[model samples]
Target: MPLHPACECHTATRSYEFSESHAIRGSTIGMVLSKQAIPDISQNGGKHADFPGAKAPYVSKMKFLNEQSYDPIPIYRVIDNKGQVIDRTEEPRIDNETLLNMYKTMVQLNQMDEILIESQQQGRISMYLTNYGEEGIQVGSGAALLPRDMIFAQYRELGVLLYRGMTVTEIVNQCYGNHEDRDKGRQIPMHFGNKEKNIVTASSPLATQMPQAVGAAYAFKRAPNNERCVICYFGDGAASEGDAHAAFNFAATLQCPVILFCRNNGYAVWTPTNQQYRGDGIAARGLALGLHTIRVDGTDALAVYRAVERAREIAIQNKPVLIESMSYRVGLHSTADFSNNAFRSVEEIQKWAQEENPVEKLRLYLEGKGLWNSDIEKQFAKEARDIVLRTIQEADQKKKAHWKEMLKDVYYVMPQHLQKQMNQMEKHLEKYKEHYPLDQFQSE
Candidate 1:
């Protein structure tokens, strides 16, 4: 009867778990069905019965918030652009004087960049790199470092060096490639290396310092010093390199005490950030790799300082921390790209120069606080200019290095063929001594 009861299944059956968690709160039954079953969830399938009039207008709809909700990562800040603290949880911890100092370091770094770049243009120096929009990142983080801690800087970190009390003369000497340079004039301009300051010498290769930084941090951990850690600085463009990923993995594996600061300035040379990756920000990538990470407004010195302070604490606890300072590179990547008419528009540059420039914001903060008046500002500018000019003049007055520099430093003794080459160079210098008169140069 009824086509044999054992063989018959008359009804269509659909099976799924019907827990309260499976029910979406704000969606209608039909809408939920349309979304769950359909490849393309749309009202075109006669689903927009709620308002038939909505069909004619063709308002494209986004999916209802079931699983995908936009949760913004918390942004940490200590001081506003006006140099006032808005957060009361750590009210007495951060004071105005500390902020002023941070502001001053930012100014000094910006000023130094301006001077060095201009010096390069004037043919007074061979080369220089500027941290045009990134002074706050380096100086603020550097302020959190202990005196004995190691700093592995990218070439454009004179601000951090200055904060550590690197004298103007030392900077000039390094730039000038003189005997007074701690590297013995081995490296080029902005390739800073000072044992006294505990800053590693910068190299020309991108992301080359990443591993070295990790090694330094590992050493610190093994040695187990309370005051020892390694703070490494690099750009967002550098993060795309393999060395960066390797360094992160190595540091995470070892729990090395390293603070990796990435100034995500939207460009690596000429490439923009949109082309870099589809994922979230660089700080998120750091977090994904099991590092304590933070992203902060790089233009805000106080926020950067506080984040760095926290990062320092984490680092001391044998955690590798990554900090991505969101900033804009307002100037050309270097002095070599002088054309304002190329790649980027002048209007874009001017907009940032007026509003987003770190130096401009710091000046505004200083003025707002009544900490710096017009007269003092003018005096500061004049003094900075004079100091830069004198430093350049002194560096230029230093004697040029001899060809023996090429043969030295890397070996305890020269090989026979190398010695022959050195002899040839010495002969060439002797023959040209009249033209480059040794007596005309200052004593090393």
Candidate 2:
């Protein structure tokens, strides 16, 4: 509250005159010193205070006071369906190897999802979720990130983990819940994680990772030396959760480097996106919360790569970003979703498959660039399926974890209550020796 040393004004009138004459109108000094409101231009038919420059026509603030809708957020795209660069000059100049890797990863993901989903249906695994139509967001956005960037992914973002160097065998072991599983068989299939890779364990509860991602980004901000960002992936349905709002607000207010990628895949399982919200989906919420927001076509890997690279560049400067990727859940949401075709029309799915297929789109683009061919693709498809089948078979040979394994990792030392429960279970199992599989409880 200290005044300038040479200031002579001590009276309210002198202060008012000084503020009115020299201070910036609505600027810091004028806002603090003056109480006079700007004249309403609607009454005098002159220039509006809010509108500094005269325009042909302007909507007064009160004119649409009752209106709630805002202008639509524009969609950004770098590539088109016909293997064309629509963004021409602005298109990202990704190297051939990197572009080929993106295409390869999408193919691997497509094959992996198909095999695993079939395995689940055959009851080889308890459950599985497929990223059938959303490989671009996982692969493209993931390819754009640095190695040290923390990634908290939804179940379908297997490509992100793959990009981060998680091996096929490791993922299959996690799916099988074998001895090689990172969580020691504690987590179910698809909830993969590895601290070494900075990929947080995925959760089943919707949007739970949002606040966690925000918290991690805040920690990164505090460290200052990490120079890393937290990129969290969730679906449009997950964005409807309360944690999402809290996470967005905190990230924006704290100016944390959190890149939130919401794959608006047109459904929360079976519930259509239209049934979830009336607003302009998740991107509008991000803008409303002061985060830099963009909506991009999810099927285009090049577009996703460019968009995420830009978002990452901004996030490193301590600004949060929200990317709502418009896609479709063209495959079963989960293995248990046997009635998927009943809830959604087959004709719509066929259209999406024929036109906006993520893997096929990238393949076409790669083929157009002379980076791929029908013969190579055919050979690669066979190799991809073989790798998955071999890995799954190897993981299956490891056998499921014993019941004793589940009670091992919960604490530094086993608590007395848990120990007591284990003792009681051991006694009960001994009494029913012939009623169950003998090796099921036995740790081998």
Candidate 3:
């Protein structure tokens, strides 16, 4: 029987395809296009000085007489588990050495995370967040970016900063909370910031960095600088924040070159994905928001690198891309969490450690290619330990900063009110001089 032209039925022209089992690995849409069909400049609620002119390039010609309603969009990706390259077109043009470097960084990050957490437990630092499981997401994305292009990150992105040439000594100094710390001892340990690297200091507040990243990317797109894009890193938990949504709308509307990288590690602190949203993956959320999205196995370095490589290309072309890297948080959310917390079972952590270890995955890949062996692991561990221990030892010996540093860097010059406050505080301290000798306590 002939089916009606508009019928939802297949006839002689139907296509047949066989599918094999495939494992699926897995931020923002602007509000203007959804609400007004035409952009409402006033709908841009906050300070977007850099966004000038048409905000939505994809729908600049649309006309509407009513308030527009935009759909919640989900994101997209290219890589999968088992280290397979499923998207040939988006495959990165990288060498084996580059691949090896990515794996090495992942291993280094794992060791660093473990070492830092131990350091915190031993009273060496005030706080720490482990980048243990999300190593590939940061390392691969960081490697794909230009050195000069600014990167804004959340608290758990030491791998990215390290890949961008941050020294272990500097990391140790910051961890030690000494005056020599590049952040001037202003933040908690593992809180990253480097003006010279053009990497903005990470604030403890969640999601704030996302919008700033949008602004930075917008500047790069509008400025005379030769740089192409900016990459911002956040966690799946951050995806629920208002700032993340706001940043996406701003970036999409302005056609800013930015990549929103979300590490969907299955939990946000004590809350699991089942508790956060009904969606199966964050990529679908990004797609609903009208973003070009990608989902990949976050535990696979090659997959992450390839996805990020293509993301960078799209960002450079003045379009935004959002990547959701699906992985696990093998460690506690931070050093502060009780190891025995019921948020996750010990058995779950053990299961992931045995199977989803990204370092082990890459090591297996390397060994399969005959490029890795016991000697490589031994040498890498020895060097990493030696270097890390030396840096920490030196940092521990450095002088600490005075409380006055709390007021420093907050202004170009001390305002009159601050000057007066500083003087008053000094006077209050002078009264205690006879009770406690300053010379005896001065850090050297």
Please tell me which predicted candidate would have the highest TM-score against the true structure: 2
After superposing candidate 1, which stretches have Cα over 4 Å from the reference? 1-74, 82-84, 90-97, 338-341, 366-370, 431-444
Candidate 2 lDDT: 0.83
Q: After the best TM-score superposition of candidate 1, give how far the Cα of residue 215 lies from its true spot, in angstroms.
A: 1.0
lDDT of 1 by residue, 1-444 (tens): 111111122222223334444546865343223223322213333333223223232337865642135444456665565555577574325467765676667766667788888888988777777787777677777777778889898877888888888888898888877666666667888888778889888998889999889998998899876667889999888898899999999999899999998888878877788888655668877876889988888877667778888888889889999998888777778777756448678887777666666666666666776777778777777777778778878877777565467577667877788889888867987788777666634443
Model 3: per-residue Cα lDDT over 1-444, one tens digit each: 222222223111233232343333422322322222322223222222112543442334567632124443322334443444457786567778876777677767767777777888899889888876677677877777778777888887888898888888888889887768876677887778888887888888889999999998888888745657888888888889999999888888888888998988888998898888764456776665667788877777767777877788788888888888888888888878877357788888888767776677667767766778889898987788778887788887776677577677778988988888888878988887686544422342
In order, the Cα lDDT scores of the candidates are: 0.74, 0.83, 0.74
What lDDT is reached at residue 67 by model 3? 18
What C-alpha lDDT does candidate 1 achieve relative to the native structure? 0.74
RMSD of each: 12.7, 7.1, 13.9
Q: What's model 2's lDDT at 203?
A: 90
Error of 3 at 133 (Å): 1.7
Error of 1 at 213 (Å): 0.6
TM-score: model 2 vs. ground truth: 0.86
TM-score of model number 1:
0.79
TM-score of each: 0.79, 0.86, 0.79
